[model samples]
Structures are given as C-alpha cells and as structure tokens.
Target: MSLLFLLVAWSATVLSCALLCRAALAAARALPPAPEAAGDIAPDPAAADRHASGLTLYEMAYLSGGPHRLADVVLVLMAQKRRLLLADTGWATVVDPVGTDAVERAALTAIGPEGQRHIPAVRDALVGDAAVRRVADRLETQGLAQPAAVRPGIGGAVRLVKGSALVTLLSAVATYWTAAPGADSGQVLIWFTVPQILTLGLWAVARFELHPYSDWATVAGERRLPATTGSRDAPDAPGTPPGSLITLALRGPTALTDPSLRAALHSSGA
Candidate 1:
C-alpha cells in the first residue's frame, strides 16, 4: 500500500511539473502582438520625409477612449516594429549574410562567437522582396501587427509556472520510493534532494542574474510617451488611452468597484 501511494504521489508530482513547464513555454510564445500605428487621421507628409532623412519617430499616442495602459502597449509596438523591419526590410543582410564562407567568417568576427550562424539564412529570405511581402501578409493575418498590452499579473504567472516546474519534480521524487534514510530508499532520496538543494543554493548565489524589475521597467519604457514641443496637458497630447476595455465593460458606479477594472487602472497608471 505504501509503495502504491508513493508511486501515485510521484506520478502526480511529475505530471504537475510537466504542466508547469508547458504553461511557461506557452507564455513565452504568447507575448503580445505588435501594435499597428493608427491610420494617421491627417497624414503628416513631413513624417514620410523624416523617414527618408533617416529619422525615426517612435510615437506613443493614447487612442481616444482607449485603455490608459501606455507602458505595455508601447513595448509591444516597439517589438512589433523591430520584427517587421528585421523580418521584412533585409536589415539582417547588413548584419549577417549567407552562402559565402568568407562573408560568414567576417560576420562571425564582427558579431562575436556567440552569434547564431543560422541568422544568415533568415537574412537571405528578407532580401527577397517577394518574401518580405509574404511575411507582411502573414503578420497581418496572424494579427501580430495589432496593438495589445501584456499585464503584470500575466507576466508574474508565467514566471511562477517556470519556477514551480523544478519544485514539482523534486516533490515527485520525494513522495515516491520506500527506502529508509539508511537504506536504498534513503540513498535515492539523497540523490534527488542534493541536486535540488544545490540548484536552490545556486539560485540564491546568482539572484542578481534575475532581472524581473528591469524587465518590467523595459516594458514600461517602451510605452512612455515622447515629449511634445507643444502643451503636455492637451487632450490630444500623446499619452495612453484614458480607459481600457475592462473599464468600459463595467459601466456606471460599479466600474470603480470592479476588482479587475481597478487592478487594470492601477497597473496602467490611468
């Protein structure tokens, strides 16, 4: 009966770990899609001219009646722009080239040894105008160019899932096997516990390697509105939208009372 219980516990723990790892992988892949620049209500001809002059204006504007969560949306938009430019404009070609061994060696020397050698293939694809058009079409279809924000809670949840995987694995091994401390069971437990303990210790030693706050700050920075030469207080001034979808959903006096709405407002600096 004890063995059966141990086996069941071990199985459950392993299953849980697997689930956590899956969740983390999914979260990593599910980063918010890039934000589409709203159709310039009045196209600034100068904006196009500026681009021609090699000046890029990364603007942040609050959509009328949209969510005030500027930070998350800004980051997504910046990432999106980079993806579009890199994946479509052949920037990769200038940085990395394909086919020629000499070119590859030169690139490796410039980018350092850790650079991905496969990047050259991606650059080659980008250089083809047809490929660029196809990639743009795919981005539109996938809604990857749409503006969306990532929430802090969601980010935290992803991190938790990643951390829990190891914990679950350890718990599984501990729950299983009947060997006593002095017996074979004890030996197996020691083997399992030692590695995890060491890992935990290493994590503590390298705690500074983790940069959760900086990551959050980076996301926030991406969303920051550029300073305008004109008035800062104007309604049309560049800023995050005043209200989010969640805020609009909770109509009337209850809007402030809704927990989710309140949380969104707090995080978004609305």
Candidate 2:
C-alpha cells in the first residue's frame, strides 16, 4: 500500500505538471492576434517624418529597446532639446524649467528637485508614471510592440506547481524509506527524480512559447532596428543623420559626434 501511494503521488505530480504547461500554452494561444499598427498614432507630417519605412521614434525604440526603452525616450528627448543634462556621475540636471508634453513632463517630474539627481532614482520615479504608461500603450496599439501579457498570473502559478512537485517527491522518498528498516530504498527513490525532470521540461516549453509576446518589440522590429552599440560612429553618415534624432530612442547618444548633437542626445556620461 505504501509503494502504491508513492506511485500515485509521483504520477499525479507528473500529470499536474503536464497540465500546468498545457494550460499556460493554451492561455498564450488565447491571447488576441498581434494587432496591426493601423493609425494608432494618427500620422502627422509635422509631428513625424517617417523613415525605417514609416516607423516612429517610439516604434524604433520598441524595436531596439523594449518597453523599458521609454527611459531612453525621455532622456533623448530632453537632451536633444537642451532641456536637461546628463552628467558622468549618473545624475541628471534640469537645464530648462519646462517640459513640452506629457511624456516630457513626466520625465522632468521624475527628477525631483533637479540638482544632479541619480539616474536610478529618476528611473524608479518615471518607470511607472501614468503618462509614460500611456505612451507605452500607444506604441503597443501601433503594433510596434508585441501584445503584452494580458494574463500575467502564470508566474506565481508556475512557482506553486513547481513547489508542489518538489514536496511530493520528497514525501514519496521519505515514506518509502520509513516503511522498511532493512530493505534498500534505491528502487523506490527512482520516483523521486520524476518530478524534478518533469518540472525542468515543462518550464523549458513555457519559456519558449511565451517569450515572444511579452517582449517589447515584435519579431520584425527586433530585426529592423539598427544593431549599433554605444558611441560608435555610424558607418554611413557624416556628422549625424537628421533621423539620428529619431534613432536616439533606441541608441541614445551613442552615434552622435557633433558636440552640440551629442550634448542633445546625452542622458548620462563621463
């Protein structure tokens, strides 16, 4: 009867692990299809001069940087217009008293008291600000961003399921050894390994299946955005590309060489 109980626990845990994976996959599938960008930003010639085949700065940022790229957006925007200064100390200085828009206002407000405020401090303040959130949503609606996880509760559920598997495996092993004083427990302990193996396998599937949707850029954007790293001369342009201002959303001041342009793109530096 004790051996039978161990088998049942092992089988049930494995089955539950499989169900957890299946449910997660099914939930991922149930999410709405990736919506087309489709006039979500209402194109204006003055507000935008389209390139990268008509994608916006925000779109390019999404492509290169993910949703967290909003920090770059604020930094680049203020730096470009000479409203703020990023110093080597990872602190920001407000040069201009005003912000031109909601995103700008939110960023400016994020740097409280504005005397060389720390970078991480500013990021924490701005990261969850509602205005910043609105812009992020706009990028998503434009289809520049992948659909966000509509159901984010899977993470905790995953942890719980994994915990249950671990516990059941331990319990089975202990019960087996306790039931017999002289008998070897080696064969009974085989069941102990089953839950651990199943947990790893199911987690792998979930990682692969769910990653694409949760990322900020769609598959296309990730490929389309320039692959340049920091402070590198853009191979094609002299001085800087006018569109480089737009690129600032993803690349920051890295590509700019002109002292004025670099100053404008600066978020933080030595």
Candidate 3:
C-alpha cells in the first residue's frame, strides 16, 4: 500500500509540472510584442531597393544583461535574385526576423578560418540608419565590452537537474507523511515548497540556455541619410527584377549602434 501511494504521488507531481510548463509556454506565446520606444526610426526605403538587388547585409551585437556577461556578432547575406537568404547564425529561421541580426553577427565573427574582410559598401549602408547609432552609443556608455567566446557552462544545468530531483523527493516525502500519520496540517507547506523549488530550478535552466553575450564592436559610424521612396515589396518578392545598387562604407562604433541602422537591416530582410 505504501509503495503504491508513493508511485501515485510521483505520477501526480510529474503530470502537474508538465501541465504547468505547457501553460507557461502558451501564456508567453500569447504575450504582446515588446513596446517600441518613442522616436524609433521606421524601416528604411533603401533597404527595399538593396534587397531587390540581392545586396543585403546584416550585423548584430549581443550584450549581457546581468549575472553572466558576454557578447557576439552575427551577419547574414541575402541573394534576392536567387531567392536565398543565407544566415550565418545558429538559429533556425522561419519567417520571423526577431534577434536574427544578432545571431548572424555572432556567427560571422566566430568564423575561424576566414580572414576578416571589411565590406565598405555594407558598412556605409548600415551607418546611414539612425536606430543603429542609438543602440551602439547606449552600449558604449554603459561600459559594456566585447566578451571572449567560450563554451556554455554546465553548472547551471547540473544545478537545475539536482533541484528537480529535490522537488520530486520532497513531494514523495509529503505523500508518505500524509499517509503514515496525522500530517494534514503540513500539507500546505509541502505543496508550496515543492512548487517553489521546482520553479526556481526551471528558471535556472532557462537562464543557462539563454546565456548573454556582447558583440566586439559596431560596424558603422554615425551618419544620417534622407529617406527616399522606392519599391515597397520585399526585395526577394517573386517576379521582381533586381534594382540598382548603391553602396556606402561605414566606420566607427556609433554607426553600428544607431537605431536607424538596425531598422534598416530589418527592412532589408537581414
């Protein structure tokens, strides 16, 4: 009877946890997009033309939030004529462009055998954006520096697994206590403690997976470009011919951090 009770309790705990995780994920998916700050630059018109011409480049920088500090840069190249969007980042791309630039920059910077080739045109185009400049300035003023690349740590994972084990063990203990003697008074305490421990353990695992990193430097310097009207469709849109190319060279950190620059990258399908 005692063994059966333990088995049942364990099953219930596992089921409950699974349901909780599913619910949490669903809630997260339903969340509204992050609020955009005032004065945020809209996507650039030039990006559309560039995209149509199969000439798009993307660079992204990662910054540490807290507890762990690291940085990375990712780059992506798009070939509009070929209907190909080559992403250097580790993540799988569907249609969404969120965090795509950062991932691409990191991958490009991580290329071991390839020598650094500065593309003046790409840099110049990025520098023309206002948004990128803002972000770069904020990062520099915050004293954030490029972080050395290293393999992710296992400490966080191990701690989480141990915590999960502890929660299961505690739940089992509660079942035994309730069945063995007059322990009804402690049921609430045990239930709350189990959930709390499990929650913390899961949070640790999530943090480890989403480890923070910073980029080496911004690719462009601050510069302003006048907005112009051009093609409205995506550069890679079906049946659209390649457009004329206009390339610029960007230099300095501020250019890369500018908010306008970031917006341009997104508009260009980078």
Candidate 4:
C-alpha cells in the first residue's frame, strides 16, 4: 500500500475502534447502580411490611416475565377462579364479566363484549393494553425494572457499535483492493485485523456486562421472585387465592400445571 493509503487505513481503524469504545462506555455508565448497592442499609420494619404489602402477585408476574407473562398469569388465574373457561381445543370464554383489578379488566376487555376470544388473541391484545403499560410504569418507578426509555438508548448504542465494525471491515477491504502489486497484502491484512479484533473484544465484554439487562426485572426484583420452577410455594396477597399466587409466580403458560389447561394454552400459542 502507498504510505498515504496506509495512513488513511490506520486512521479509519483507530477512529472507528475509539468510537465503539466510547459508545459502549457511555451506555454502561448510564445504567443505574448495581441493585445491591443499598444492601448495607437496613430498612425500617414498618416500611418493609408496607412495601411487601404493596407488591401483589400481578406485579410479581410482570417483574418475572413482562407483559406477556403477566397476561398469561391473569388468564390462568381467571380460569382457576372459575371466572373464565379455557377449553383444551384452544378457546377462552368469560364466566365473569367483572374484574377485580386493572390487569383482569384489560384481559376481560381483550376478550371483547361477546365474552369469547381465542386465548392467544386475548394475550396478544392485552400485551399492549394501557393497564399493562401502567404495570410496567409502576415497576420502573419503584426501581424494580428498567425504564422503557433506557432500553432504546442502550439498543441504539449497540447498533452504532455494530455499524462501526462494518465500516472498519469495508475500509479494510477497500484498502486491500487499492494496494499496488508487490505490496505485502498479508501485512496489510494483519494491520486491518487489529481493529476487527478490537471490535469483537469490545462486543464480548459488552455482552457479558449487559446480559442481565432483560425485558423484565432489575437485579433487586429478580432477587425477590419466588423460585418459579419445580416449586409451587409462594405467599398469597389479600383476596388472592394461594393457587393464583402460585400460577403468577410461575409466570406463564408453563405455570398451568393441569394437563388440560397447559394443552389449551399451548394450542393457542401462549
């Protein structure tokens, strides 16, 4: 490669790699502190009770698996309560028109005034319900979940990093093609590999750090979830049955331990 071409290639590599690092670091720093940062501080007994009391199983379902899981939990619970009928052939018919909470009301409305709807359709409709958004908003406000707005920021940063990697690759290819014959193409390739390696390394580290940024639950909220697998034990909320609490903790159609109910949910794509 000509001396000028080599300089340009290195400059592009360096600039792209630097930009990737900067974007990744900025996204990481913008995250809230570790969930356990306040662990050393003891909470007041009265306040702890109040906090515990305020967290219903519906909220827990949202924390465990986001809106879809919350919808599943509500549907199964309604079935268990005889407020809805779930047929093994993949249908849901409302047995009770009245709903005791916003999530239930949303599910009911999704089922429509006709009182019947496909289970998957109801679940899909409920996922975007205002009631479901309110549930997310509440959890975000309580620091139990990441804010919806924060997710797009990190997502956009990651996309930019990927774009930078692509730019580096294309620049390397162009430089390789433009080099004069008898130039050490292998050496040129090695020089280009440095930025590729840097980009891959940064992506690996970023993935490790950001793996826990899931759609639902911060670390603190995850810590509070009852073991949903292979266990049915969980505390019940007022006016909520123990069975309903168990179903909510399980978080989705998999929680439908009854064979018929599970079949019904699965058939409907739940």
Candidate 5:
C-alpha cells in the first residue's frame, strides 16, 4: 500500500511537471519578445505614426488597467470638461447629454436617460459594455493585447501545479499511515520527496519566469505605456495638463492630484 501511494504521487507529480513545462512553453510562444528586447530595431515610420496617432486616450486606459480604468478616465475627463458631475460622495450625474466618444457614450448609457447613477454601478456596467469589448478586440487585432481566451491559460496551469503539490503532500502522509507495521514509514515517506521536490522547484521557477503571464497587454502595448509616474502632490485638475489623465490611467486612482477627485474615485470603487 505504501509503494502504491508512492506510485500515485509520482505519477501526479510527473504529469503536473510536464504540464507546467508545456504551459510555460506555450505561454512563451504566445507572447512576443519583451518590449525592451526590440529596442535595437528601427520602427517603420508609417506604422509608428499610426500606432501613436490611432490609439485614443480611452484605449490607453484600457491597456493600462482594463475596463474600469477606461471608465475612470472617461469620468475624470467629463468631470473636467463640466459635462458630468462626479460628486465627492461617489454619485455621478450627467450634465451634458452628448458624449464625445464611444466610451463616454457607454458611460452615459450606463447612467440611463435620467442622467444619474452611483459611480460603482457605472463601472460594473462598463465591464460588459460593447464599447469596452470593442477596445479589447481592437487591441488584440493589432497584436497589442492578448486574447481573453489565452490570458488565463498559464494561470490555470500554475493553479493545477499548486493542486498537484498538495496532493503529493497528502500522499506522503497516506504512505506513512498505510505502511506495514514493521516497515520504516520514514523511508516510505522518503519516496515522496522526489515528487515534492519536483513540484516545489518547478513552482518556484514558474513563479519567477511567468509572473506576469496573465496581464492584459502584449509586449508592444506594454512598451507603449506612458513614461509619466505622477506625483501624489501634482495637483492635477481637469484640463491642467494632458499627462495628468495619462498618469491617472497608468498609476490608478491614487495618482489623482485633486482631493475631491481622489475622494470621488476612492468612494466610487477604491
């Protein structure tokens, strides 16, 4: 019975290890080279121009932080333009019935024709909004973001390996409990060390090498992230500087320089 337990543990460990390796390879193949790795090459002028010009602010927000971030950007921009009211208490009231872009239009639709809704509800609604989906689709089409289907593949593999590790540990305990009375249970437990070591070692390496495997951006999109890391004290108000919103998109709500803006953002969904 002890030997049988060892066999089962070994089989699971080996299978999981193989799966881990395969997942890592698949993830590596799916991703383009790291952004910095391509620095030596010259960019195509027309392609670079399109890349710079075609990407809108809302799309940048999505690339930085997905749907919620895009929603935040729209809200902040609208508030600045006096088209919407973002109360410090987390309520959003639309002032202007018109929207400047698809994302803003979606936000308006989420708020309903009455022009009032809680900010959190708007953020949640935007997640499944067609405007957000279009942004994701366009990014994927341009090879600037990973497909939603492939994003979870490596993460799922990592979780499976973690489960396999737990099984190996339990099997070790079972081997000791099921051993013949005269047999050295410690020695039987020693057999489990092989699988345990295999699982743990691979887990550690995978954690290091594939840490950001589930992130939204592809290498190209990541490379295009704004360079501004805004100050907490930057005091950025709407229409103050273009980089202010970009900073908010990249760094999240914490980067909001206005106290009311910060409060509104945190109270909404922090």
Candidate 6:
C-alpha cells in the first residue's frame, strides 16, 4: 500500500479503537452503585426476629430492590395495615388518604383520583413524584440506595487516551505528507494494534472486577438476599411463608395471593 494510504488507514483504525474503547470504559465506569443494606441481616438458621437489621420491610425492599420495590412494599403494607384496597381486576383503590409515613403518603398520592386503575398505570404516574423522590433520598441518606456520579479519573483517562491517539495520528500524517511519495508504512499497524488491544483487555478486566454496580442490590445485598434458585442447597436465608408480606417482597405477586401485592406489582408495572 502507498505510505500515505497506510498511514491514514492505520491512524483511522487506531483512532476508532481508542474512541470505542474510551466510550465503553466511560459507560462501565458510570454505572450506578447497587442499593445497599444497613448490614448483613438475619441470614440462615437464626430466628426471623433475629434478621431485623433495624430495617423495616419497606427499607429491606428499598435496599434490595429499588424504587419499584419500595413501591411494592408500600402497597402491600397499606393493604395489610388496612390503609388501601386492591381489587381482583388489578385495580387499586385508595382506602385512606391519610398515610402514617412518607412512603404511604407517596403511594396515596400515586393512587390519585383512583377509583381503580391498572397497576402499571399507577407506577407510571408515580415515577417522578416528589414523594417517591423523597423515599429514594431517604434511602440514600440511610446508606441504602447509592447513586452513581461522574468519575474524573475515568473521564481524564478516556480523554488522555483519545488525545494521545489523535496526536500520534496527526504526527504520522505530518510525516507521511512531508516525505516523498511511495514510502512504505511497513508494519506500523501491528505496533498500534497490540497496545490498543492490551489496553482494552486490561480495562475490561478492571471494569468487570470493580464496580459490579446494580440498582437492585449492592454487592453485599446480592450475596445475602434470599434467592429462589433451584440449587441443591437451601436458600442462603430461610424461606418465607406462603401468605407472608416477605414472600411478596422476595418472590413477587405470584408468590402470594394477597390482593395488595398483585395490585402493586400490576399497577407499578415494573
């Protein structure tokens, strides 16, 4: 290939690779941290009461599940506490406007003008409500729902890599243009590809190892939460009773026939 063509070709590939790598790295680094628990709560053979880590069911749902889960928790709690009603048709009727807590108040507001509406409708309506935000903010303050922030180091590294690639490409272009026609590019592509691939590989390894962010559960919560996986062993924690509120929290609406859970899960549409 002509030296100029080769120079441009290789620089283009290098620039593309650098930009793609930086974009991927930036996305990975920007992932939000998972919702966290106050502490390792009642796991295993301990009594159910022993599992209380100062977090109520609402807190547990928030810590392990996120906003929709919190909404689910509130709905079920309201029904159980006789503050709300869920119809058989997935319609949620607000039984009482006066809620004992902020979350309940949020749900009450979320179910606004509701003689009955599908569960998903309620969730959509509630998405950006101030009361919902307050619950999330409260959880964050309690060390539960940790959000992601822009990372200067990652951003700087991305900029540096991209800048270096652009500068090197510019230098190669200048040399090629200033030289005589028909100069050989030789194996310069190999020189560039090897290091670029290595950088991406290293970055992939680091990204996979660190962060591990999730909106549902923190690293600790992911390990501790009771799962319904059909592993040969028992759940890491104990099982919930068929009709218990915890069953709904851990297993979703189908686990329990509670009208409230069905109403919440369906209404929230999450």
Say which candidate scores most in TM-score: 5
Q: After best superposition, candidate 5 residue 1: deviation in angstroms?
A: 11
Candidate 3 structure quality by residue, lDDT tens digits, 1-270: 444544544454465456445533443343223323322534433233233322222211222111111111123232222212223322222232223343223323333224232333233334433434444333333223222221122223334444555655665566566674664535444554554566566556544542221123211111011111121122323442232111111111222333443344444333
Largest lDDT belongs to which candidate? 5
Minimum summed lDDT over a 10-residue window in model 5 is located at 44-53
lDDT of 6 at 127: 52
For candidate 6, the 10 contiguous residues with the lowest summed lDDT are: 41-50
Say which prediction, candidate 2 or candidate 4, comes out ahead on lDDT: 4
Model 4 collision count: 0
Candidate 1 has an lDDT of 0.32
Lowest-lDDT window of 10 residues in candidate 4? 42-51
User: Where is model 4 more than 4 Å wrong at Cα?
Assistant: 1-55, 152-189, 228-251
lDDT of 4: 0.66
Q: Mind giving the per-residue lDDT tens digits that candidate 6 earns over 29-85? A: 544444344454333221123244444565456555566666666677777787777
lDDT of each: 0.32, 0.58, 0.33, 0.66, 0.73, 0.53
lDDT of 4 by residue, 1-270 (tens): 434555655565566556546644654464456543334434322122222424556667787677778787788878888999989988899998888777788899999999999998998999999888876766665566766545544445555556666766777788778877777777767776776776667666766665443456655565555543212344443464444444545456664558888888889887
How high a TM-score does candidate 5 get?
A: 0.66
Which stretches in model 5 have alpha-carbon errors above 4 Å? 1-55, 159-186, 204-209, 227-243
lDDT per residue for candidate 5 within 66-111, as digits (tens), equals 7888889888988988989999999899999788777778889999
Cα displacement (angstroms), candidate 5, residue 81, comes to: 2.5
- The alpha-carbon deviation from the true structure for residue 64 of candidate 6, after best TM-score superposition, in angstroms, is 2.9
- In terms of TM-score, how similar is model 3 to the real structure? 0.23
Sort every candidate by lDDT, greatest first: 5, 4, 2, 6, 3, 1
lDDT of 3 at 64: 17
Q: Please give, for residues 32-143, the per-residue lDDT of candidate 1 as tens digits.
A: 4443343513343323422221211211222111122222222222223332112222122133322232222233343334433233343232233342233223322333
